[model samples]
Target: MTPADMPSVNARAGAAVEALRAASTELKIGVARGTSGETVIDAGGREVGSIAAGVKIAEICMGGLGDVRLIASTATPRWPWTVQVHSAHPVVACLASQYAGWRLAHGEGKGAFFALGSGPARALARKEALFEELGYRDSADTATLVLEAPRPPPAEVVERVARDCGIAPERLNIVFAATQSMAGGVQVVARVLEVALHKAHELKFPLERIVEGMGAAPLPPPHPDFVTAMGRTNDAIIYAGRVHLYVSGAAADARELAERLPSTGSRDYGRPFADVFRHYKGDFYAIDPMLFSPAQVVVTALESGESFHAGQVNLDLLDASFT
Candidate 1:
């Protein structure tokens, strides 16, 4: 038998599955590094292919909301803010880009980094400059705040940015070392927290209470953010194991959207998912109420050729990310 067909490979795969199960509670999202044309997400922190950067960002956005967004255009669309993902590691740029778009839609303000290699210091400067170009003030005290992550800014670099942004070091909330993956992007997670805080305050709620709800004992209820939903959709399309498809923006009119989806495709019975609804959009899928995570929902749809739709509601459920 070939080496791959040996017991060792199966053992390793089994171990990886166990690890994934063990860490599933802590890991809400993960980026799939395509291995041998097969994408397998593991929780043990190893297996399949390189996990790469941006998994933290994906997890945060997905946990916060049911979907994520993509740039969806050749040129940068006019937006309120922009965050550029700098890949200190060259090969992970695509994964990083996927993460960045997903995070941005979740109201964290993110953009994609074109160059990938060493020299994050230089890359960060460019990101800051892009933020300025998007009309955000250089100062942190301004209405808009810029956040970076997964990588720490050196003391000098931090000092320089603080000075330029007119903010003190204490104002900076850098989760330098991630509680999960040591090399994972805590800074990005911190930024997501920062946005959540801003959202909580805007909703006239306590940030601590919101966080508590997210990390409660039995695992918090599904609090889907529209922005996060858009981001998650993008991620679902990209790293999904089977089919990849387009997703609508949270703002799309429901009836109008319904009219657009072409109802055509052979309905397959006995799909492994909760509910396999047929979409006129050429055989779309919807999730059963049982599936909580957007990633899972998307994965199920991709595998089963089903399209996802939120009944005829006003999308009010997507409050967190929409506003």
Candidate 2:
């Protein structure tokens, strides 16, 4: 492992799960061992997950390489509740761990189970092409994965995960949170910085140049309807999420990055994400990949001590989506 990645993402995430398990009841999350012996965490599916639970879950999703927090900000009074996120290791924390790039599937047809796994376990699984680019791998006696499914995964799937992660099922933990749950909203909204890092990577900006990063986005109320809830959480970022990146690069490069990093650059920028999803017939791949970034940004060129700004908050779109 690289010096910056010394601790190993899985090891850090394992520490987080231990803490989550210790305070499961206070966090209002359901914790139980599956038949296969893997620990299952119900952040919202079986129990009403709280915002505090979401914050901790978000941190775990980053492989505990980052910090996630909640605060009330007059910065956007109309959407007062917000989630703030930061990481000293942006590339490792956001892409290697939190990007939800793992495609896990079991069975066939209607009975098939599928979820894009996130969190620290991905570092150990090395399932995505992303890990190749990262050139980093980790091993831990314990593993933790965060899933957005509405219910516990099949025991077969959990066993597969443990095997892939090279750990005993008893040493693995799976965290489940549905998009419509309150805790779910916080976890999704907390991806503001991860979204920025992802877009920056997509933009082909130098990941090594990203020295430090921070982001914030409004936390919308979770909707009972899955589509609306997903829309609100996504719109919270695409309409008002803000990010600041400290990069070690030339001013021109920084300015170019700032201009292209915001959601406004996408053809699908103006509408709520749910409408965009319907327009594309529910195929996420059909939407412009550029649409997944924060709405506002500041990219600083550390070499030149200059910062470039781009994008703006669309309160109208925010209100339309939230209400």
Candidate 3:
């Protein structure tokens, strides 16, 4: 081929080199030696390159990852976020309150919203420094549980005290104290006795004799429906096991102590004085540890109208006292 007709080597090579340099700069490539000779490849910052043997350096330099360009469209966009703290315990509630307190102290946002009546709620209220001194805006507080009834500290009261403190009666959230006895004990054991009677019947024992043995003597012909209803609730998760029993009472020497009773499918009838204690440990989360023996906790879970089966337990509602 004539020199004039053939492409000019220097001009073609120069043009190719210039094009490569422009593309390499855009790709942020660095010079590196490969099979044929030195060539331009990936920048070697965050990416690596592989080339075929005998290939010319110019050929390998021809391709690279495209430049990354950030596009600008909207100047500002709105983003919204929210938070929730779900807890029935005073301690956990307290932690959430402190978190809110920190946010308020910083004045980070427009305003703070919170659910009141967790232990933390009371703790936050008690912080006179925040409200009285610093003047933090008070957030609305809602009571989770409240109760009202007319009764003196008990007929056996020595001195009377006002139920309401500095807090307004309307603002005050109240929960009933389980009845206290003359001995300062509230024994809710009648249900346990009734359960045992029903179980005795299922075990093929005489229902009448079992009922008579369980305090039927005092009442003049007690309602049979009461016994039947008790039996049904017991059967339907009021107790564990097809034949589970719950024994409880603070009476130190009750003849029907749990320890003396036979073992149940879901309980340890010895050592712990109540079947509820056994249930509490077996299904810990289903019962509040602070208010019940693991056993009592379990019993409460069973007594809970909610349905639960083996290996599944409820998230637990704290006893009114704790929450």
Candidate 4:
């Protein structure tokens, strides 16, 4: 499909680049101009980023396709910096979450660099099942990506990304952050809503029926260690994250869907995610597929004006996991 015909997560996110640049110094983020003239924002890599930087990183994670804001949490005083996210275009936002997310691995062997590809560019790649299922594609002169790694992506990796997006190498924009950094934690926790949407999709829920999506999760403190950081981030979502989705569907269907939308639905519900990850020997796919959901989910059917709620936040588990 033509660029205009498809949802442009990159275009939406590109609009915010200037604002991020203008506040780079204040946000404690570093902006670098690549040789191809592509703009790269370093949210955590080579910089000690702050919470403001994390918010921007979270937005970038959604391919700038969703709205991310900070708010206070009523769940607990321990986590005050709760992130709130909403997307009118939930399908596009979720697509951005997958395509532009940290799911793709680039390179092999010693030189191989694993990066989470984000941006409107993933629409052009069309490599994953979600893209085909959505029947959506995007075309853009410039592509953007967010890499959850410490260093900038290699030149070859950038070239490969540009080629996949059908754009020149210079027309690429990349954002980098390490998972142990402040920006990394915020961006991952920001996926609370996305996780729910993905779970719904996995369960064969009607994507078109979802009209609005919103989610909230406490922002855990960032750890310099990667494993510790990953654990905390996952715990924030699986144990304490809460989400609400508005759909245009039958009330009964919405209620049934709600019953399956929380992390508790998984067999791996009680333990902290870090322990669970180790239990699976760090094989992400080996873990319970149902565990990758939010702590609570509520679906409101607009047609019937009936809301279905399921799941509950386990603060005690969250405390143990966070500690």
Candidate 5:
């Protein structure tokens, strides 16, 4: 817990990569090296990808600081499973490591390849402004990144990532899944806690005061279409994600945070996320940024032992998205 005990996110993620490699066959995931020598983990894009493999990728996405568990549940009626997540180091694990903030692009038009790079590799790249705000930078001989894409990254992108991280292309690792695959759905839904932490940071809440965090969201079936699958994964959290935080702050601040943290606080909260995306003319940046958050939140002030709850799960919208 001291400055001297600084943990390297990349180091932790590298360990997770080793574990994933050991169990790739059992998990039904593919493991290969990229043309650029970077390691590529095929989790959900191929015919062999499985939900269990996606769970491992989710862990790596948080730099091994978070726990992602699958639970059998009928609480949502439509979903038989739920993804539970928690992190003692929410700020570092979720915001610094898990958030998909790095935009990697190559080529153009039909042959174009674009993906938001998320995971410990981000700490090394320090490409996003959020890293500067966090005042954190990770260094390690090996780096790992998580991508939500339909295919393996191009050699150019892989080399770019390797160069940006100041590591050999052979030392870089990428875990990618198709957004329309079941493994992808599980991994995305597992980001419920990270989404909450990102929204909290966006609201200017004191990140250091957030001591503990946990969240859960129903795991919807993946759709065949990319956009629809994206919608289903997002709706899982926007409609029914439940997040709890133990924060060391004034009760008033906790209450205020709870009031402002839910997806309902956004003007774009009435319908499914896809509908809103279409309303914004398919421009993700054009949509309200505040709309990306849990549907329900309970912020408990650790100082006063009081909890402030805000927003309610919207089953009406959940039903609409799941079917």
Candidate 6:
């Protein structure tokens, strides 16, 4: 398909930008203009990232392909926001995850920064394996990215991003959220379902067969320390997240896929992510690849209307990790 025929992540995310800026005060977020003239929305960096801001960030992450809702959680009252996501365009939404997901690392040294760069700009870069597999690309004059960081990117970083997206710096829009803050937590937890879809893709499932997807996870309280924050966000998915996918493939294939989709399929399944992180000595790539999946997954084959389920939520592990 042509670029014009495809959905634009920047265009969809841009709609939320105005609303986010308008409610900056109510959402406890700060908006600023970068030296490179890019628009920057601060979630947990210089300002406190509110639940509302997190919701907006999550929407941006999905390229607005899906709906994100903040619901009350009876399971974890302390972490009140239960993030729920639903998408009719499952493949497109998953493409959004690949294009703009927080999978990239940027900058260098103490002056360096790490960001899960999301939005349509990734298609322009086409640097990752997922992008190559999707056989998709996007073209737009303006680029949008959601960065998980504690501070606004440096001028050079902004310029680099614009360059990478093949756009002028002034045309870039970057949103920032730190992992150790409320906005960061909400945005990260929001990916519980997306992560599962990505895993299915990794396992070589026919992504186009997925017609609908929905997922939910408890929002963990934000932490000031990055490691602790990472742990909590991961535990939310590994121990408590649940996902359901409606697919148009064979029931047996869907069932087989479900059996291999959850975090329990990995060797690193039993511990809090922090401990696992330490065990791997902070090399994210060294961790069990399968451990990145959701705690539970259910797939319904549209052809036969049969539901196949796998994995289980380990509440004990969640409590241990959260505490």
Of the candidates shown, which would achieve the greatest lDDT relative to the real structure? 2
Full-model lDDT, candidate 1 = 0.24
Structural RMSD, model 4: 2.3
Per-residue CA lDDT of model 6 for 134-252, tens digit only, reads 66666768777877788877787788888888999888888888889888888888887778888888898987777789988988877777998999999999888989999887899
lDDT score at residue 74, model 3, on the 0-100 scale: 22
List, residue by residue over 197-272, the lDDT tens digit for candidate 5. 9999989998888889999999888889877889999999999999999999799999999999999999888898
| Per-residue error (Å), model 5, residue 26 | 2.1
Point out the worst 10-residue segment of candidate 4 by lDDT. 95-104
Model 3, runs deviating above 4 Å: 1-169, 175-323
Task: Give a tens-digit lDDT track for model 1, residues 49-149.
Answer: 11222333332222222121212221112221212222111111111111232111111234322111111111122242322222211111311111222
lDDT of 1 at 64: 20
Clash numbers, per candidate:
27, 0, 9, 3, 0, 3
lDDT of each: 0.24, 0.90, 0.21, 0.80, 0.89, 0.80
Clashing pairs for model 6 are: 100-118, 100-119, 102-116
Better model by TM-score: candidate 1 vs candidate 3: 1
- The positional error of residue 46 in candidate 4, measured at the CA in angstroms, is 1.2
- Which segments of candidate 5 are over 4 A away from where they belong? 2-5
- In model 4, the runs with Cα more than 4 Å from the true position are 1-7, 35-37, 97-111
Task: List model 3 lDDT by residue over 217-275, tens digit each.
Answer: 00011112322222222222222111122222222212222222222333332222223
Quickly count the clashes in candidate 6: 3
Which 10-residue window of candidate 6 scores lowest in summed lDDT?
A: 96-105
